[model samples]
Target: MNHPATPQEQDYPLSAVPLEARKSLASMGLVLLGFTFFTATMWAGGSVGTAFDFQTMLLVLLIGNLLLGTYAAILAFIAARTGLNTALMSRFAFGQVGSKLSDFILGFTQIGWYAWGTATMAILLVKMTGLSQAWEMPLMVVFGFGFCISAFIGYRGLEWLSRFAVPAMIILIAVSMTIATNDGGGLAGLSAIVPSEDMSMAAAITLVFGTFVSGGTQATNWTRFARSGKAAVVATLAAFFIGNGLMTLVGAFGALVYQQADIVDILVAQGLATLGILMLFLNLWTTQDNTVYNFAVAGCNMFRTRRRKLVTVVGAGVGTLLAVLGMYEWLIPFLILLGTFIPPVGGVIMANYFVAWRARYPDLETASLPAFNLPGLAAYGLGSLAAYTSPWIAPVVGVVAAALAFALIHVATVAVKERRAEMMKPV
Candidate 1:
């Protein structure tokens, strides 16, 4: 396959980002923070908030986000070290052709997120403004395509939007939280509140972790541009651990105070409908662009093309159609699948890089790889199965199972080959 001789600025979808093109910690941190500040995460938080007391809910959010942050940070460090995103890294674990499986899985999940966000933005606009119900579908198409413009411009576009949006979002969140605390009767009233519903700790953690695990797996797209592994790790941890944790906190707080999980609804109840709508737009747009950009990167790897802009537009179109067809309702099941299947990809990639490649991959342009890597494929399958049936935290189970399976399979395969070679020697 012919790789591009000269890559476009900041988007090296088919190749590693060069050292000169790497970015600072604050740049990557802002972009990732924007991506993690999502509405669905709030919805997931709302679910957990209603299920437990405030103290227990805080514990669950902490544990769940810590797992997510650590997982993403590992991938981010590897990406920064290798200058390759998850899709490109998958080529080593899953092989050149087999990597398409990850491309599809990762790309499709991002499309789901894009569609959900698009549908959400349109639906809420209509609900809040008393626009005709008929306007929702048209609005979805308009917002869906509009959201991809930043993604089409690639990393630079994402950085510009995030710089403005992240701070504005933070301010909005702080305002909403202050109002919520006062309305809930402050610390005494909050502590006095009891759970109105029940959920297992495992399930609650899953809800928190599962909501963004897929996005975390693919965050390497931006993390690959980090100036160093330390920068990547710090930025990713801040985004997933703090940014995502804060989102869940807001949602849960809203749920506990007003029996509403969505931040927009919470704001509306607080008589900040104007600011809430603005927050909603900023929240979804930041994440929507990133999500579509992710799909474009995965598509580039899948199709072996450097036309990321073209692929981005196509991805938005597909997501828009899905939104019109009712993707908003699939949020729960989608998160569950993401939590179960996606972590194993990261697991296999970690094992492949650290164990097989010894923490260094050969230059992508010169490396010779097989069409398929059977050991990696088998390990992923086994890992996914372990996640499916395990009663513990499924995402964590999947990652560990897949990594162990890859190691054992590699060792066994090498031993058999060595024995066969010994048997064939002249005696």
Candidate 2:
């Protein structure tokens, strides 16, 4: 297994992982753990904790992460087998030009997240330093550019940042939990407490699952290097189930005990400022790098070019501008209103690989693809609609609906084509 990615290879995001370049499970696990362990996960957990009882929130997170892990694992397995990233794989189901739509979806969402995350860190940093509001814009620029430098360096930088940040996050959360527990009257008190507000079980599940569905859909960007399908599965499972779940627990713990959701804020409240600053930087930096890196991958694929570094710079500039303009508020409502749209992409890709194409992609060097794969596009639409209107689990419904719709449409359309050709034969 290739342990470290080549510098030249990381610069170009248009190609699939070569046969000799697959990586070991340990490497992939650590890399993804760095990504899955995020501040946003903890923030979502705070909302979860305030909405439900201790036991209920625990159950919701456990079930939600498992569901999230399942689809991510599917994408990871395909990536390991085909050595293609999600944006590239979308071409199989979405057609050559049509796949650009996927590129825009993935790229735009990541850019949105990048802007929101950078601004969030800036606001928090200003508050943490007790600085005046004037420092916020300066800090936002400083942090945004500083983080994009790592992204400009590409995957190696992300892996390095992840390796250190993942463990640091664990230590910070452990210490933060210990302080919060002692000051808030311990386990008995936490268990005895009630939710501050009412939240439906369905809504809680949606929040937990929807928070990361966009990123999870692009798991192949990180998992394409896995040495085998086993490596991909284990990496995805550990990252999603354990790393993600831990984030929620950390958030819930702080929110329930101290009414604070942001872990940095929780630590700062407990007089852990120095450590909070460190944890806060590492947490936001790793996520920002991953977000921007994925955005670059999508951008390069959309343009069918190898100039990912140029794309990286462009993406960072746009995201930084959006951040300064306060796009987070706009993204929040859009993210929820269109939450079901992203999950179907994973579903369509999975359906195309596992069922339609029999788990294999064509030669990346020369493959003639359709101009538009209507079956897949239609299936994605249906799946997203099901998610939006259904009373059941939205993400789950979206995935199943899209997968089934693609398979059915592909089979039926092929059969009709064959029959028409047979009837139109020279008689």
Candidate 3:
């Protein structure tokens, strides 16, 4: 397959992607597809299945995905317009040095997720193959490093894998979904079925939103490669709304019918042993590849180094250790917390890019930025607090609160700067 040339170390963390290196719409779409078609998402679907009636489940999924998709689309637009990854763009709002905080949050979260995915894959492998328990750690290492190498290759590797894996995954997932649907007695039967567990509508929405909010916020990492804004929007919409939505529905379908949320579990229960293994492998690989890539990008930003490949390797090491420690079982609560805190970063980015900078950034190569950006800092803090305390939709509250806080703080800063300039001129 044709690919972009390897990015040199000098250009790894700081520079905008050169226009010539931008990707076509189809390629970007495929990459996003690889990300959204994750086993974790299907697992989240299982959460959906236990909770609500069919109509409620569908409503929750649609509303939740719409929120996730809309948030991601805004980030995608800025990324395409600026050709900057989320970490780089964050420097605009968070300051050159202060951006490290955002980097830490994003990078650390991705590593945690990588660990969770690795653990999940390892256990699933052992279960499916009936391998000895002794092999689980070794399997985790193998899968972790395997996915790590793909990210080490950077965007080109993602493209190659997505090109092959995305299509294959779609077919395999379709088969699973169809089998589950048929077993549950088709569309009519699914609707008529009663829910086994009582899940509040708010909780269901939170489940869907929490599943991908962090990933969605970091979308600029991939969308920055899009050739145009339209491509970025289209790719994000297709992946977050359509691809991620399907994942939730399939999980819900299984839950409502078979009382299973995991697509792998559903597949195994359905007697599609071979297909189950294939889906499990592909699903984990696609998600972990992107997760590692996210970690590498954030690591590069945090350390202010261009050693992306080295960072990728280190991240794999850390994630593998966590997986061996059984992080998968304990990471769900952390992920939900992540959903609340992460959206505020997106809101801050939106305000900084659209309202403050008005879609233009001074040349980052030589542009002067503050040591810190207090407005962004304040907004993020307040947003997090509101999410924790408010009874409303936490993701929405966090995002809207942050955006408004940034805007207000920005206006105040500009006013103060203007007054100082006027006084100096008169004197």
Candidate 4:
């Protein structure tokens, strides 16, 4: 691992964040809230909202977000204690050479998100304002690179943007929801709405959990800066559980009342088209930068470089190219893949930290790790298999399967070593 040479690289792509660099609870919370306040999440919520009655939708939201928050909070706690992000932590669980697998998977997902967001921003802007369709690609290129500006500057830039953007977005969402409730004739009206679409409870939970599980997996990037373990856990729960839940609720509300899942579309229908445009920009920008930032962090680990700013620019370009190539149309399938594959990485890391490492990872600078940790990789494979075959809560199944598999392997290996030692004694 190379030492970070610039202030921007102090995000420590290849190393642990030092104590002096840790951030306050508020800072971590705000940045995470910004990440969770995403448009896609609302779209996911809308899918659930249209399928179930209001009361059932709320129950599904609570269960799904609580599970997502718990998963993210556990990883955040490890990150804060170890001062390492998911990619860096993977070195211990996946081994020196094998960690790159996680790097590529995590990095690829973030780039996919970046491209989707870039395309979304461009397409939506053109449709909402009646711009010529020809301008969409050029706008994708522009916003693709533009959103990474703060990411290029690193954590300070992210925190600064979130400080302003999060509060503003929250206020806008609240205002929209209030208007929606009034138009729908309040609580009785909301309760009176019947399900218009058919979906199983399992599918609804999968939609809610799968929508952001990939992003949640990498949230350690921000939470790793927490000043304490408690700070990390609290901030993570607040963002994933409360902030994300609110986004889902807002989307569900809009879908039920206005028949529009996207808050932007709902706003436009409400004669707030101007504010809708503003909300779209802020909503996508907040998540776009964070997504690109996550890609850079994984890029640094994958390439073993400390130049995060360079990686950020390069990632934005790749994402832009993907957007131009039609990444926007791939959302549903992409999400299914994310739900099936991404959670196992987090599962392996949790098992590596608690069971294998006994809650302590050695300093990366001097640790003697193997080229590949066979058990971890095997566990990940088994976990992915379970997730793919499972009918209910695929993400949760993947996580538990991976963790349990790793622990089982650890026990078997220990027993083998003990047996060999016994046979060799006094011989």
The lDDT leader among the candidates is: 1
By lDDT rank, best first, the candidates go 1, 4, 3, 2
List runs of model 4 lying over 4 Å from the truth: 1-5
Q: Which residue pairs clash in candidate 3?
A: 46-261
TM-score of 4: 0.97
Candidate 2: tens digits of C-alpha lDDT, residues 42-153? 8888878877777887899998889988889989999988888999998998988889988999999898888888887898878888889898778778777778887788
TM-scores of all predicted structures: 0.97, 0.95, 0.95, 0.97
Question: Where does the lowest 10-residue lDDT sum fall in candidate 3?
Answer: 1-10
- Name model 3 segments beyond 4 Å from true: 1-7, 420-427
Report the lDDT tens digits of candidate 4 across residue range 51-115.
Answer: 88889999999998999999999999999999999998999989999999999999999999999
Per-prediction count of colliding residue pairs? 0, 0, 1, 0
Each candidate's root-mean-square deviation in Å? 1.6, 2.5, 2.7, 1.4
Give the range of the ten consecutive residues with the poorest summed lDDT in model 2.
Answer: 1-10
Error of 4 at 416 (Å): 1.0
Candidate 1 residue-wise lDDT at 242: 100
